[model samples]
Target: MSYVLAKSQNDDIHNAGECGGAVTSIFKYLLDEGLVDGVLAIKPGDDIYDGVPTFITDSDDLIGAAGSYHCAPTMVGNIIQKYLYDKKVAVTVKPCDMRSIDELIKRYKIKKENIYTIGLNCGGTVSPITGRKMIELYYDVDPDDVESEEIDKGQFIIELKDGTEKGVKIHDLEMEGYGRRNNCQRCDVKIPRNANIACGNWGSQDGWTFIEINDEKGQELIDGAKNAGILETKSPADPAVEGRLKVEGIMKKMASKVQSVKYPLVSEMDEWNRCIGCYACRDICPICWCCENCELNKDYFTLEENSSPDPLAFQGVRLSHMSFSCVDCGQCDDVCPMDIPVSLIFDKLQKKYYERTGYVAGVSDDVKPPLYSPEKTEL
Candidate 1:
């Protein structure tokens, strides 16, 4: 592993990117150098809050994807698995997205060699609708006037178009149900170490990005970008490194408190009674790719007259099949029409599985989960 403070040499990129243009420059280098066919990243749609994933094949178009949107919450793993499996692509990933890719790679659903992951350090993401309302209710400012948003030091900050900023305590917002998604609040994986490179502003001075190169591929990406004269780098100072670690520790501690409060035993969740057998949760699950021959579709598992399914048969089936690999990305929770906390049970089970087996899913390359292995030995 290696650490460095880097920034874009290009004036436009340096200004357009969130902290620095390190990630965008790397993608540009990959595209210009013909290392990848395309880049998968988010670009603003109708507004800055409306972030939509875009696939760019041209180096010039990479500028549109610069900067970050905390409201996007789009998942690129399924997109890659479904569409870009055969093509070489560079993509930015949040921790959950990286975890989904790792799980998919292990399942042979995605080709590892064809994809390069540039992981972002994520605090969390707020849903678009909720975020807009949050601005109106809490910040007392028009959400449309906001040009940029950030989560830093326990505050949700927004920069308005008139050169003014507003800040709100994240804890206060969450107390009123206005902060990040429930799964995101409980997420402790702030850094995607499994990616080729992890980049963020945590350990850097202003106008720079702090990067951790996890492998040879990441080192090559950095070196190539610098060689192309689009990026510059320097070693980070000791205090900056310590500050980053301290911030990470605080975030994880917050996550642990949230987990205890949000994730109760599956037995206690009464929202399952509202399920309509729509199968939306399964459809949105990143790991649930069995389309034609899902066990839940079988006669034994499906009651012909009943629209509400047995929780054990439906959610339980999913937990057994993929819970060990669940990254708790919250797609299940997002798509559930009944508003069930679908990820809660799966996340709890995965954590329990980790406790029993000493396995943390999607974080390691050398070990596979015991359920996926042929050996019957207990941990």
Candidate 2:
């Protein structure tokens, strides 16, 4: 067995695209500590999977590990599912990723001993669909042409191999769906609960990071780094981190917004009028469409095969019914070509479900999700 720790330092937070250095550092630390036999993470490459899942046993392989803020890293989830069949694997994920893992653990789809998680504190994530399209439309660049990338101060910087560069400022891309992810807009779990160690931009004064070890495993990794002299722990903030306060302020504002608005759910059945019955939302969801025996896929909603008296009629029902299965990760809304707010249904359901059942779907694996446990039935 070996050690696993998730660490990243990327401005984009899309998929660990920018933090190749930080990811390599952690993998090296784990190798030294002998806590992991292998690490599962995304690495940059020229293959079709430019940002594809990688299993690194040799420390040298980790050099290719990178970071991004892309929201739909479904490959990470698929990798976790696949590897759980064998040895323990350490993985790096953002807050949203952590939540999905928590949900999986509850379903007994993954075992704790077989997995070690490192969570990155997330401010938000970008839709990769939008990212790829923006590059193609604005810069005439393909997703593979860029060697590396980052998003900061409202600018999308793509470093190309031809010594050519492409940059789109946030203002220019504001109407371009740059900051659109259903879960991000309503996310309350800024700090991930499934991680053994959490790292990110939360406590730093400058662009540098302030890593926080949350568990014994995390502590071991950090301590090993200190012993190896790969990293140095500094004193607490002097006047406190400047952006820390700003982040707190913005979260409060978002919380208020969540409270002020009503979420749409399939249970309501009235919110899906805009839906053309295209099933686009279902196809794009990261979680709900996991099964091949999908009832919706068989056109079970229609009176006849491939027939619907009214296509949009089932949209609201579909969303409300699927709310319970939703982690509020927002793939449904992000994928809607019609710009329908499918996530709003999950958001309201999450709030209502949390209030009624006092449960959060993907917080931790320490206990079963409250909805699934009848040992302490409130009813």
Candidate 3:
């Protein structure tokens, strides 16, 4: 509903946080005021590439989750459904993340009033393994020596501890099949406005984050943070606003082109023949909540360990049931031990469903929703 160029007043937060720390400061404010019991966010686990989803119940621990993790491909909705339901929580959401959360809200699994969603503007995410290999192969730098990574100006840039940086064109990396995850490469949703507010470095200058407030809750977060003296705010210049829209527009065009390329169907592919029926994909899907009593577990469909799954009966049943709702998060693709591109399968299904019936995964409209597109200019 509004836009602001915001930064943190605290020097510590400004120095440590990504995009001037506005997001971290807001989380700190929420905790200090006891508005929420905890924060659900991502943090470095084994290293920068290993991002672990964590729940922070104290204000002091919030800063550990401050910076962005482009290499971390995680979904928090399933974590909430399995562990933190009924808790008053604040969480960070990417486009896919918010889409799954939106679906969950529709299902009445999580209450809107109890959760404050901070949407992160996402270009896309790199799988940790793929990222390391890419850096080694393309950047010609040791992946371990890299201290940070960022995607900007169509390049994947990595910074070293010595303060030196190297960049390689994303197109080049992706052309080599080494850049973002397969689902991310074609994902069209770049901003998660379903959250209270979306914050990122997309359109802001060096020391601030560009924010698009989407609702009253987002307004309250900004106003409350500023009133508490932890954050500073100013209206974004017209160019900065336009630049953000332009970036989203370019990304959508690329995604639409990628979407149009037809891949052979699951029935036609030999890849699905390798499925071990491990249920990893099904177990990891954030949208498939009925797994405990899933029909696939029935004796008729069950297969002995190491037996290949029936292409039509196993994956097909699941796809037909939930393909209309797939957000292309790629959690299924990420967990498949057989290395089958499950998300691609679901992506094709989602598009075909839309063609037959004019509804997106979460939206029931005849056309792609404007909220998910970069068509707005006045905001």
Candidate 4:
């Protein structure tokens, strides 16, 4: 995709209002102008423990849109399953989530004409809970001891109230490699080519968000923004944003280097042993799991109700059987109370399945999941 010169900017691209502030403002503007019935974006609340997806209609309801990233792609399916019949909603989603939407439409679950999609350019998102733990373990202090943390100067600075501090490169942290969802590593779709409108750090060189118009509807929205004086045209290259390009490049290279390293199934089993039979992995997976009653909970696997050790040679084998279908979203890893690396086990399995069968999950809506494909095809 070629870059276009648009709004002028000389400020740090990260601080650009459109990429962060303007996109959020536009959500409010749409609500005020009645352009969309409502907008769905991230809303911050008391649940610092877990981020909740919210459906908002009024401009007064928007919160924390600035923190949007590529975390929850499954919410699109949740919306389609629930609201596809009776609503025309504007939803903000990351590049991967938008791809899921495209897949949903092909499944006849959602209609393109009935929805407006705002694509956010991703700078990559980490599981805040996991990242926070990595920090606490590194510093060996109560997490509350951290007054503030800043990522700059090729390192992350952890500030303490005691007027003492330590610095670690963003890469030096263990959670850095674990930051991205596995599906995202195979993804190179930086911009949603199918989106009505797309914005992110990639569109503009300045700290400002680069807005791209992809369709007549998107252009109309841009016209409305321009007419309202909420927008302006600027060159793509702003020195402040350009200066950070090297840093972004370094992070991307590091991620790529890790991607090239081979992780095999033998290593995965060691990781899987950390799983204390907690089925949080199954609950967090966002794929085709259509079961009214899971066998894991039934007498089929359990020895007895509220009973402990197995009476026989077999303990339990449900996780081994079910984990093969996992999509490697890493939500399992993030949600585990025990802090088990279950997603790592699934990631290795997924890699093996992909290598042997050449099947990838959620790549296209039109394509049936590999397991459901014809037996002859597998043969």
Pitting candidate 1 against candidate 2, the one with the higher lDDT is 1
Per-model CA lDDT versus the true structure: 0.87, 0.59, 0.83, 0.54
TM-score of each: 0.96, 0.71, 0.91, 0.64
Better of 1 and 3 by lDDT: 1
> Model 4: how far is 149 from its true place, Å?
7.6
In candidate 2, stretches whose alpha carbon ends up further than 4 angstroms from where it belongs are 1-20, 32-34, 45-50, 67-75, 132-176, 205-207, 238-245, 248-325, 334-340, 364-366, 375-379
CA error at residue 77 for candidate 2, angstroms: 2.7
Candidate achieving the largest TM-score: 1
**What is the lDDT, from 0 to 100, of the residue 138 in candidate 1?**
96
Model 2: per-residue Cα lDDT over 1-379, one tens digit each: 1122223332232233243234446666676567777888776444322456678877656655655534335435545664544666778877767777766666666676776677776655656666667778888877767655654433557778786777877446645555435456567776664587766555453434445566787776666765775544554363344454465466546645654653423443445555677776765554543546656556656777667525555565565555555666666765677666677666676667767766666763437656556675763
Regions more than 4 Å wrong, model 3: 262-269, 303-311, 363-379
Q: Which sections of candidate 4 miss by over 4 Å?
A: 1-20, 33-35, 46-52, 67-85, 99-113, 130-168, 175-196, 203-207, 212-224, 227-229, 233-252, 265-278, 288-327, 337-340, 352-359, 363-379
Q: Quick one: best lDDT, which candidate? A: 1
**Which of candidates 1 and 4 is the stronger one according to TM-score?**
1
Residue 213 of model 2 has an lDDT of 63
Residue 364 of model 4: what lDDT? 34
Q: Please tell me which model should have the higher TM-score, number 1 or number 2.
A: 1
